[model samples]
Target: MSDTPQSVSSHTALDQLRQLIQQQAAQQPLPGERELAERFAVGRREIRRALNVLEEEGRIWRKQGKGTFVGPAAPVQPLMLHDLPQRSNLLEVMEARIQLEPGLARLAALRASGEQIALMKRLLERMQLIALKDGDQHELWDSAFHRAIAEAAGNRLMLGLFDAVDAVRREPGWQHLRELARTADRLHSYDDHHRRLVEYIASRQPQEAATAMREHLLVLQQTLIEAINCGEEEQL
Candidate 1:
């Protein structure tokens, strides 16, 4: 179901250690996970995952609950990697957001400051208040909520990437589409999702936070796409 954290951790020791394992491992079995972890100066989790990667690639085999051994290499399983897209179209923007934000939320769950999470909670409260009263402040608070999550990620690059997408998201036409999609009828659901995202991040459950963020964006993406296809005068 939720596999985002493993994917997130795959980059660090997974790549370097994998290459080392492939190059060094030949006819002999490799060192146990503890030895590998000490040699690599990484956590057992990283070494374990690196071994899992090799096993998946058919470059290594694990004997039930025992040691891992080298095997003839097979076709590699392509690792999931990403870079921000240059396109600013709605579909492209949404796709980019989907790719980056969930991971960012995962990072935030691991690293977010208490103060930052509190700020996000305040922003969520503001949105609820705006929902109650007929007002234009909802958009501002919504934007703040996302930016807060980006800040909570504690990665400058992640923050910058989020800011870039958010800038495009503020474009008048994009704003209009979002307004159309995020209608009064669907606002409560949106609020609930946002609440869940904040709670997960605050609770420090990386996979749950990532999944929550992914689900939230997917709903937004679907709503926005439908609105774009239907035109402004139409209500969905």
Candidate 2:
């Protein structure tokens, strides 16, 4: 389906006003409220109501003499995990993550704002710091890193999906993979992929972002498969 339009009348009006601001940003500020009301087929009261909502939402700014303009939208709120699946299996987590993460990355590449990209950069730096401090806490940081990216995608629903997968972060196989994945060689490779994906997103290269995302997951999948196979061999 196409992206849902802003539904609440005030919200929709705010979005329309924002779009107008964007279009006219370099040229001139928008017309006065009376003109906007006429243009949108709404009364002046309705325009003022919409502007009030937009102001509260931080989607616009207004000066006493100058007139109203756009504001930076609010940063996305953190997602909470509740009513999600209670599984704690590593294979299940990895499989679900592989299914969901790449698409989110691709969308982020297409839709991410400057604020979101900055947040992602902060997360990457934090991940690097954690890796340096703890040496090989891949299970914790890797899962957090991915979830942070999903959240930065500005899609709360997908963040919740990733959270459900993350709930199994302490499973034995997950720990095993983290241990195996902690080596300097793998860490550099993994971090490289993460950086590349973030860069592609910042550059608004959806195809490259999607490719980087899939490649990152494939590495994890291959590692997990090899680990499972080796375990089976030992068992046999």
C-alpha local distance difference test of each model = 0.68, 0.62
Any runs in candidate 2 off by more than 4 Å, and if so which?
1-88, 130-139, 232-236
Candidate topping TM-score: 1
**Positional deviation of residue 72's Cα in model 1 after best superposition, in angstroms:** 55
lDDT of 2 by residue, 1-236 (tens): 11111112333344356556545433345579999877876566557756754454345778889987666633332232433334344566677777888888988888887876876676577567655444323333455457556766777677666654554443333444445545566667888898998899999998888889988988877877777677667779
Q: What are the C-alpha RMSDs, in order, of all predicted structures? A: 17.6, 15.2
Q: Write the per-residue lDDT of candidate 1 for residues 131-228, one digit (tens) a residue.
A: 83532345545766776787678777766677667655554434456556766667789899999999999999999999999998998889888878
State candidate 2's TM-score.
0.57
- Model 1, residue 14: C-alpha shift (Å): 41
